[model samples]
Target: MNRLMEFIATGFYSGKLPKMPGTWGSILAAILLYFLWPTNLKFQLLIIFITFILSVISADYVAKELGNKDPDCVVIDEILGMEIALLGLSADIKTVFLGLILFRVIDIMKPPPIGFFEKLPGGLGITVDDAVAGVITNVILRLIGGLL
Candidate 1:
């Protein structure tokens, strides 16, 4: 169980890399989005919700084991963030790239409401900020989609 949690938290050991584990996790998420993407928004939301629950559980355990608040290696947050960011967006290269960039930027910037989520306890703190970033990205994409 611990090993499984570690596997999940680490983004399949992409987090074990020496630097920028979150980025690696996001990359993994992109790959996953490419392959396992759902046919509709309802299924997408269900997938994200399940991932959210599992990520929180795994992230909390992994963070505790690592003795850190939001340890860099526990990048389940990044996966959730990317999933949310790309929600309803097409799986084309352009959409994926834009979503990835938007998500990473918003996540890094951590502005306002997004930043606020970081203060929550345990895995919520570790994950919600990123999810908020993804939401912001979704809004941005919606605006772009509307403009086009």
Candidate 2:
């Protein structure tokens, strides 16, 4: 059970990658989203909700085990964030590519409310900032989509 949670928190070991594990997790999310993410908004919301629940559970477990808050290796947050970022957008290459980039940039920057959410404590803190970044990215993507 611990191992299972660890595996999930680690983004199936993608988070173990030496470089930019969150980025890797986001990329993995993109790949999974291509196949598994539903086009229907309702289904998308359901998936996001479920993923968020799993992310919080697994991330909290791993963080406690490792004695670290917001450990880099627990990147289920990135997966959740990526899902939110791409929500409702057309799954076309251009939209997805833009979403990936936008989410990554916003996540890295951690500006404003996104940064604010990082102070929440426990897994919620670890994850919500990225979720906020995802919301920001989604908005940006929507604006871009409208433009082009």
Candidate 3:
């Protein structure tokens, strides 16, 4: 059970990548999630809500076991966050690419409440910060979508 927990906590082997595995896994997850986008806003919201909840719990446990705060290997949070960022956007490749870039930038920069949220303890901190970053990315995407 311990081994199983570690494996799941480590993102089912995605975390074992030699370099930037989490980022790569997140990119892949976002790409996959883009294909799963529902036309209905309510459904999208439900997916995002459930994913966020699971990510917070799982990421926290992973970080604790890995002895780090928001370890790079624990990227389920990023996957969930990026999925949230892409919500309600057009399914075009261009929109997805733009959202991906925007999400990565906002996540890396950790602006405002994102930065504030990073100070939180445990997995809540790990996941919340990325969630805030995702919200920022979503806002930017929405603004751009409005303009174009």
* lDDT (Cα, tens digit) per residue for candidate 1, span 48-74: 999899888899999899889888998
- In order of listing, the candidates' clash counts read 0, 0, 1
Q: Which is the better candidate, 1 or 3, if ranked by TM-score?
A: 1
Model 2: per-residue lDDT, tens digit, 1-148? 3889989999998999998999999999888887777789999999899989998889989999999988899889999999999888777777777888888998998889887888898999888999999999999999887887
Candidate 3 Cα lDDT to native: 0.76
lDDT of 3 by residue, 30-92 (tens): 677668777788988897788677777777777777778877777777777787787787657
In order, the Cα lDDT scores of the candidates are 0.87, 0.89, 0.76
For lDDT, candidate 1 versus 2, the one ahead is 2
Task: Return the candidate ranking by TM-score, descending.
Answer: 2, 1, 3
Clashing pairs for model 1 are none
- The runs of at least 3 residues in candidate 3 whose Cα sits more than 4 Å from the true structure, single-residue gaps closed, are 1-12
- Per-model TM-score versus the true fold: 0.95, 0.96, 0.88
TM-score of 3: 0.88
RMSD of each: 1.2, 1.1, 2.0
